[model samples]
Target: MAIHSPSLVELHAFLAVARVGSFRGAAEALHVTQAAVSRAVQRLEEQLGVDVFERSGAGVRLTPQGTALRRRTEKHVAALEAAALALRRPTERLRLRISVAPSFGTLWLLPRLPDFHAHHPEVALEFRQYHHEENFQREDVDLWIALKAQAHQRWPRQVAAEYLVGREIVAVCAPQRARGVASADQLLAQPLLYHSNYPDNWALWAEAAGSALPAQWRGTGFDLVLNLVEAARAGMGFAVVQRCMVEDDVAAGRLAMPVAACASTGRGYYLCRRRSLGAHPAVERFVDWLRLQCAGDRGA
Candidate 1:
């Protein structure tokens, strides 16, 4: 006898009934009537020339032949359903353009991108290094991750902001530099590394340690925090930087917090998105995942 192919609808109905063990339950699951599910399964069995289910007032159970057939075909049916689902989803890849602070992108965000890609393989991300003179109105960026001072509330029109992480500045230096630094004064006696963008970081750290910045302090200044951190790691001087920026280095023992003094910089990392792109599915998924990542890191 020649074998006939079963319809996908019939196969789905059979699997649903087999899974739930009831025509009514399968109907509810498939959002069809009980009679429709029953007829579909009946047609499937007729085409196979074998009784697939043993029916009783209590419910239904797969027969030996049905069990064998289901075992062989369940995975195939699932794959087909998945393929159909893929076809139903948007065909074009979603492009998500994000602008992020340079240091944060390199030190913090880049390492965690594999996790994001594992979760959202469909989203194509393009990153631009955020700068002070970013023209959001002209740029085609969808999201921007930047540091915002507590008092700076100005945002472009059609932009919404969400706080991701707080900025806590900690004084860190090479292990050699931390050896004799027992007190805040002693720690301050050594050279200090300054970030030109935030030259008052040392003063903030001193205030947090209950010590005042000296009238004249000595140190080399760099325009970037990454350079300052490297200088400190090279034993040039102690440097004050945002905790997140140097967290990995601190954990790896490349840097040491000598004075145990940490001060809030009154600034935070903010995730801003264009209002029109707020409803985009890829944007929504990325935001949700990013928020979760930040929350987990904060708890850690």
Candidate 2:
């Protein structure tokens, strides 16, 4: 005999009755009348040419064939329920996931994120702090902020990068620490803090200030620029940092430039993204806002 497909309504009713062991219970669960549940089950039984349920003093019990069919139908019903639930849910919003250096994320990007949200409320932004180079194969990251040198040298062919802003290195210390320091040599004589990654920052700044470093110059080293800034503010030592990073601290009197000289490293921050997403609207808005921020920094 040829097999026939059973209607979803009949299959649903049969599974409900098999689970509850009665048409009345199934009707209550399905929010339908008992007669409707009975007819649906009966239709399924007739199509299959087998008795699916047998009435007893206890109510009703599924036959062996019914039990086997119920097991298969349960999976189908669950899948259908899941599909219906998914369809009923609200549509997901677009998210722009970004990866950036920890220092930049904390000191620069985070402060300006609220402005982006205020202007573009519909787009969601997510930031991940990363210290290493970008991996294009990672699907989670839509964009990255990296050092200009690293961006130029290491960016993959699948990605593109644009220069954001070059940094002006300045020597900073707590107000008390700067009170007596009149010259670069005097500032260098005191305890100096340095970023571990940029060991030559102080040397470069000294060159720009037309001052010579004392032989065997050394200082405390921190892996992150943020930590170095904090140490300087706490009077742990004088720190040579990017001007942009400490602009607010200087204005707030938490830190002071020991010397008025600033040096340009020729290195800068770069905004990078996958080439495929170069024209994406969300990416464009963020990049435009970032450029405006950078331009404002230059004007400052």
Candidate 3:
């Protein structure tokens, strides 16, 4: 005799009941009426022509045939369920792993994340701070918010970089420190804080101000822009920094830009991604949003 093929619905109902050990429990698990579960199990057993389950006053137990069926079909059923879920929730596949420069993430991106999430809630994001000499190919990152000095800076093979924002330098100090300083010439005499990454920032800003630093001029050097900003805020010295790094502090009166002179280093942040992955929907969505944000920044 030919064996009858059971419907997927019947198999699902049977497995629910088998796993829960009761029709009522299965109904709860499957969010169906107890009668519906019972009908499905009855139809399934009739088609199979075997007692798949042994019923008792307490609940139910799987018979030898039911045990065999479950052993053979469990994994297949799980896979089918997962596929169905994936179909229903296509955004689950739109996860993005981004590597961001430490200063950029802390000073700019982090503050604006709420807006990003509000706009694109379906795209899942994971961020790790970008490290020096980090191998982009070896890392598990899907995108990078990397600092680049020039548009032509070389990236790993197959990686593409797009400019986001220029690193516009601003000379800042505490409000009290600015009081005694009437000119860039005078400000030059005060203590000057420095970021280790940009040793020539002071010289660049001074040149923009039509002045130059003394050959022996030096002060504290901080590796992190965050700490450098804090040192300036605390009146440790005058500091030069990328405007975005101190926008919030300046707005909140924690720091102040004391000079009208601004300088550019031909450096900026870039969005980097593998050329092959550029077609991903999540990548496209985020890149567009970020470009809009950068446009606003450039306008400012």
Candidate 4:
């Protein structure tokens, strides 16, 4: 069955007249002449197939149907007004949704997010984290910040990618645990920490340091870099971790890079998206802002 819907203008007028109880009073509130208010209510009545109000010498009264319709229409009209206000607002005024790898987000992105917030006060950022790459097709996020090596080919592909961080992984551990990794011989002799995702890290680091550590020298596996680094900080074996991720600990003297024995890791961070949103003002501003912040790391 077909249903008739009242126009916004007429609905608003009906609501105002219903509240004010008289055409003259409603006209005063709406900043229109009483005749206009009368005409608007007349149109609203015609649209709804009923006489909504009865005009008397002193005031106006609502019919039984008009009373019920007013109750329902009041809520709907308020909601519509709010939606219209949102549509008229600026894009930068809205919040942005961003997704990223859990390890990188916890150790790196979150720490620097305050700077992004301060720089772009208009764009409120919303963060989401995942343990591994997933299909962005199912999500409605604006951007993704992925962590991988410079040569790491298995990364999210549906989004346009931009380099977000460098590929420099430093050997990090507590100040005391930093002793055994001083030389190739000592490194080969000591227990080495390993991230489950990067099983060849020990091999890669050993070759980069020109050491011949046996593949058997690798130790217990932790799936997350943060967990591996945490274990390293607590006197567990040493692991090659991103410099930026552990820079705070190194500065605080909790973790130190006694030896810079690492590879170019061919993997780095990449900012991704489902498709080119075509230089939307909000997107362009965000990308530009991110580029400026990551430029310092790129320069290094």
Instruction: Please tell me which predicted candidate would have the highest lDDT against the true structure.
Output: 3
The runs of at least 3 residues in candidate 1 whose Cα sits more than 4 Å from the true structure, single-residue gaps closed, are 1-93
What TM-score do all the candidates reach, one by one? 0.66, 0.65, 0.67, 0.64
What order do you get sorting by TM-score, best first? Answer: 3, 1, 2, 4
Model 4, range 19-55, lDDT digits (tens) per residue?
9888767765554566777788888888888998877
- Candidate structures ordered by lDDT, highest first: 3, 1, 2, 4
lDDT of 1 by residue, 61-124 (tens): 9999999989988999988766764565463336778898877788789988999999999888
Whichever of 2 and 3 has more lDDT, that candidate is 3
lDDT of 4: 0.73
The clash count for each model shown is: 0, 0, 0, 9
Better of 3 and 4 by TM-score: 3
Better of 2 and 4 by lDDT: 2
Model 3, range 147-257, lDDT digits (tens) per residue?
885535687755666778757888899988888787888988999999887889999999999999989998889998878988998999899988877877888998877
Instruction: Tell me the spans in candidate 2 whose CA falls farther than 4 Å from its real position.
Output: 1-94, 129-131, 149-154
